[model samples]
Target: MQILIVDDNNPVLEHIQSLLIERGFESVTASNGLDGLEKAQQSHYQLIIIDHLMPIMNGFQLAKNLRQNPNTAQTPILFMSTQDIGVIKNTAEAALVNALITKPIDENEFISHVYRLLDQNTQHQSL
Candidate 1:
């Protein structure tokens, strides 16, 4: 499955990309929200892992935009940010992201969340 990862930090982007790759997952990346939105428009992704703070557009904007686009309306999103989890959680339902993950992420939990979202998508598709 293909995943899109958007983060302003180069190291974080590389680390997440590496982790996903090691798990045998294909991933595409963008440095900021605007670029990520452009990439999202160009392809179908099983899931998107996006950072909350970014240039041009933020994660909330990105999620709102994605929801408005028919092609990506049902795509699952995982929000990763350094912000408070409660704040992120509060906006998640409105933004339509499937889950919120905090920064300095725990690798195992991140992977678990990824699989859970993808699995849920798969199950939804089958239904």
Candidate 2:
């Protein structure tokens, strides 16, 4: 599966890429929201990990646009944020997001969340 990891932090992007690679997913990394969005349009992804606060474009806005596009409407989006979960939910409907991961990352939680979304995406494609 092709997965895209978008984060302004190089360390965070690399860490996520390592985890996805271990899980047998071919991944791409983007430094910011604009680059990530462009890449998303260029190729379909099984999953996308988007960072909440970023320069040029923020995670919520990026995700909102992705969902609006026909090509990416069903693509699962996982938003990573250091801010409170309530705040992120307030910015966008909680149910609209596939999942949310809080920062100071936990490896297991990240894998579990990503796996669940991937499974869901696969099932939907089969239908």
Candidate 3:
């Protein structure tokens, strides 16, 4: 499966990419939200992992844009943030985010969410 990971932090991007690789999943990375939006529009990804706070565009805006495009309207998104969970959840619901992961992320938890979302996506596609 292919995943798109968008974050401004180099280390976070690398870490997530490596973790996905370890799980035998391929991924593409973008440094910011605008770059991510361009990449996402240009190709197909089974899942998109986005950081909440980013330059040019933010994750919420990215999600809103992606939802408006028919090509990506149904794609599952995993939203990551360093903000309060309650606040993020409220905003995420509007964006139709499938899952949430808080930053200072726990590796195991992150991978678990990734697997669950990917599995759900696969099942959905089959249907």
Residues 32-99 of candidate 2: C-alpha lDDT, one tens digit per residue:
99999999999999999999899999887788888889999899998899999777777545655789
Give the runs in model 2 whose Cα sits over 4 Å from its true position: 93-95
Against the hidden reference, what TM-scores do the models get?
0.95, 0.95, 0.95
TM-score, cand. 1 vs. native: 0.95
Prediction 3 global C-alpha lDDT: 0.91
Ranked by lDDT, top first: 1, 3, 2
- Model 1 lDDT, residue 103, Cα: 96
Give the least accurate 10-residue stretch of model 2, judged by summed lDDT: 88-97
Error of 1 at 98 (Å): 0.3
lDDT of 1: 0.92
Task: Give the alpha carbon lDDT tens digit for every residue of 1-127 in model 3.
Answer: 8999999999999999999999899999999989999999999999999998999999888988898899998899998999987877775354478888899788999999998988898999999
Off by over 4 Å in 1: 92-95
**What is candidate 1's lDDT per residue for 18-126, written digit by digit as tens?**
9999999999999999999999999999999999889999988898899899999999999898988886676534457888889989999999999999999999989
